[model samples]
Target: MDGRRPEWRACVLSGAVFAVCMAGTTLPTPLYPLYQDKFGFSELTVTVVYALYAFAVIGVLLLVGNASDAVGRRPVLLCGLGLAALSAVCFLCATGLGWLYAGRLLSGLSAGLFTGAATAYVMELAPEGGASRATFVATAANMGGLGCGPLLSGLLAQYAAWPLYLPFITHIALVAVSAAVLLRLAETVRERQPLRTVRPQRPALPPQVRAVFGPAATASFVGFALFGVFTSVSPAFLTESLHVDDHAVSGLIVALAFFSSTAGQLAVGRVGVRHSLPLGCAGLLAGLALLAGALRWDQMSLLIASALVGGVGQGLAFRGALADVAAASPGHRRAAVISTLFVVAYTGISVPVIGVGLLTGPIGLEGAGLVFIGCMAALVVTAAVYLLRRPEPARV
Candidate 1:
């Protein structure tokens, strides 16, 4: 272990920067309806615009998710920050629907680059003894950063002037400051390769890990799907069904899930990898049930309950699956394997939400949401059953 004081300091700094960049990605969450009103688009168009970001993220992850492991973390992260800035610029210059699409695409690229690279970078800079805390820092930064995005934007957009302009403007300032901090941080990958040497990392599981990867990846998919639906459609539900026009309230309702997700991930340290997965599955089941109640009753309390419960399930399952799969992977192929898992997880974020969008045209938003919850619930249950039948080894 290098065990240098500079290393720990840099680790925490990088995590803060990671959070800031991630916050930019979701800042538009609560503002989407405003964009829709301005751009004059359909609900389906909104989902399409939102899903575009996930597709872009998945594309970057598959194309070069492990690039930081080769070309050094700093360079790749800097690239991500650049994309983030470009996204902010896109949003700031929004004149029509195309700008929104461009912004989301760029944001996706930024997030895809940041997700694996920033995560590994933070962990690498920590003191060897501080692995557990460092892991929490990295994961919490990811989910928490995501949680803050909408809340910040919603408040500014709702009460502050220039809703469209202010959010991106504020994010631009954050990106600039974060870029300065990031530049001062140390590069963790000492023996770096050229960018050209990095190529697409397809999901290749090791034989031993292959057993655990399925249930784990499935949990990740289901969790992310729940989040996707929430991020894309739940706001519309809040406004239409609950008669909530308050952007702050809408943002807070959405933020609840991501915040709960961070709390759920933190629980993994105490719960252990073996138990977190099943517990996550349980949380997911309960969450889905709550969401069904929300749909049936149209109660604001039920909706909030669903978000909190579902977020916890997502966090527990994702963290547990990630730790187990990472442990089971051979050192040489570890990055690619984890990237593969993320590819699956990110796919969940896009496809299912789009499915809901399509269904919304045929049925109403609530009806489509009911169908979505039912489908996702069945998948989560299948995954839970499989995990029960083939429990992960305690150490893994």
Candidate 2:
């Protein structure tokens, strides 16, 4: 116990660093409209730009998801932060759509490197016998950081001098501070190898893990799909349908969903892993209903309710899915399996968002959003029913 304090402190600091880095990925969420006006691009182009980040994340996960285990956590994390800084620099110097794409790609790469590595790193830094609490820290940092990005950028852009440049500049400063903090932390890997030895592993499932993977992955897909639409297109919905054009307001609305998700994740410990999947699906279904109402009636209140309620459902489902999958996976293949799950979740984020964008031109934003809500509602209901039919195997 005497020697554990420093490591625990390191865990907290690392979580903070994780939050800052993740925040960079969504800094432009509120500013998408500004970019559209500046560059004169269509809504489809915006979704495409957002999908570029998800694509880069999936690519990195497939190629090097477990690189930190081979090399070391700190190095990969530092590399991620460096990429994050470079991304901010790109945004700061953005003169065209290409720069935005480049910045988003770099941001995605940063998130990809950090997602698995940082979560594991935080857990390792915790005092022994604190795995559950550490897991909460890791997850909260992940979701909380995502929540903060838009809020920070929105506030700065609303009140600060340089709406576009200030947010990235602030992130650059934060990254510099986080890098320094990271330099002081000790490496967790004992027999770390060189990065050159790292190779991509195929994201395949073993026959035995399929039963546990199925429901968890389904809930995750539905949850992430909801988040995908909210983050990618909610601003347009607010602007075009509701006549709410304030960037700060849009950012706050998006941030609410993520914040609510953090709350939902915290509830998982009390809810227990066994119940989380079905409960999450229930919440997601309700959320979809709220979103549908928002689209149908064009009510801002319904949109806000959807963000809060749906976000909680997503949070519950995603974290529960992660815990279920991780517990069932063999130690040797845990990281790979988790990476596969993330790929599925991210696919939810990217594909549905792009679908909404594509449909916006034909059906308009509200109609496209309603269609998305219907599809996600169906997915969530199916997942819930599946979970009900096949109860999770009882834990000892």
Candidate 3:
């Protein structure tokens, strides 16, 4: 217990750093609507702005996703933190629409660096035989931090001075603290190579990981797509249709999906990885159904229900999918493999979201949302059927 204590502390601290970086990625979520009003941009423009972040993330993941594995995790993470701070600074200095685009693009680079590297760092910091607990720590930090982003910004934007400025300022401070924390943590990669040796990794699965990759990637894509739509447009939906203009309320509603996702990740431990994927798909189906009802009836209750239910579903599938893929991967290539999964996931977030945005002009937000839901439901259902037919190994 004595020796394990320090390891556990390091593990938790690493997760904290992970959380801070992810929080920065979503900090602008609740504020997108405000930007829309301030800049007088169309809903399509808002979606495009949001999708830009994911695109940058995808670009980074493809280009240099495994840099940590070669040069060591610390350097990559520090770069990520640096990028995060710069992203925040961009937001604080926003004088026009161009600034928002630059900020989000930089934010995406920060998240892209952190996602694979940090998750691997947190898990590696765990003491021997603590993989399961460490998995929880990493996943909770990711989802919890994401949930907190909107919640933090919403409250500040609604009640505090400088709704736009204060949130980014606060984020900048948090990034500083996170960087300090990261510097103190020991690097987990023992066999380090030069940065020049860290070439871009094409997204391909090793033979061992191929089977698990398919179902895992499918579920991850669906879950992230669900999140993409919710985070990108839910605020507008609340304001325009439900007549809910409260920033705090919009933020809370968005946060619920992420918070519930954390709750769902917890359930994976009890449910077992074997069952969790299919079950998560089922939850997604229900969540999609609820979202349809909410959009069709324009009911606030149904909207909230969709967030909670769908979030849980996302949590279940994502954790299960990640665990399986990680277990199957060779340690040398783990981060790259993880980044590949994220690429697919972020693709889900970007492509479908832009599609929704494109539809919004002709059909309206409700119509666009329903169309998005229908497409996601079909994808999740396909993933569910596949999972049930060929359940991945229940390693965890």
For model 3, residues 6-123, the per-residue Cα lDDT tens digits are: 9999999999999999888888888988898888999899899999999999999999999999999999999999999999999998888999999999999999998999999999
Question: lDDT tens digits, residues 1-396, model 2?
Answer: 768877778889999999999899889999998999999999999999998888888888899987887888899999999999999999999999999999999999998888878887887788988776677788788888988999999898888899999999999999999999999998888888988989997788766677788888889888888887888898888888898888899899989999998899999999987887899899999899999999999999999999999989988887788777766666555566777888888889899999999999999888898898888888888889988899555321
Score residue 369 of candidate 2 by CA lDDT: 87
Best candidate, TM-score: 3
Q: Predictions ranked by lDDT, top down?
A: 3, 1, 2
Q: Estimate each model's TM-score.
A: 0.96, 0.96, 0.98
- lDDT assessment of candidate 2: 0.87
True-structure RMSD for candidate 2 = 1.7
Local distance difference test scores for all models: 0.87, 0.87, 0.92
lDDT of 1 by residue, 319-354 (tens): 888778767766555556777887899899999999
Off by over 4 Å in 1: 1-6, 394-396
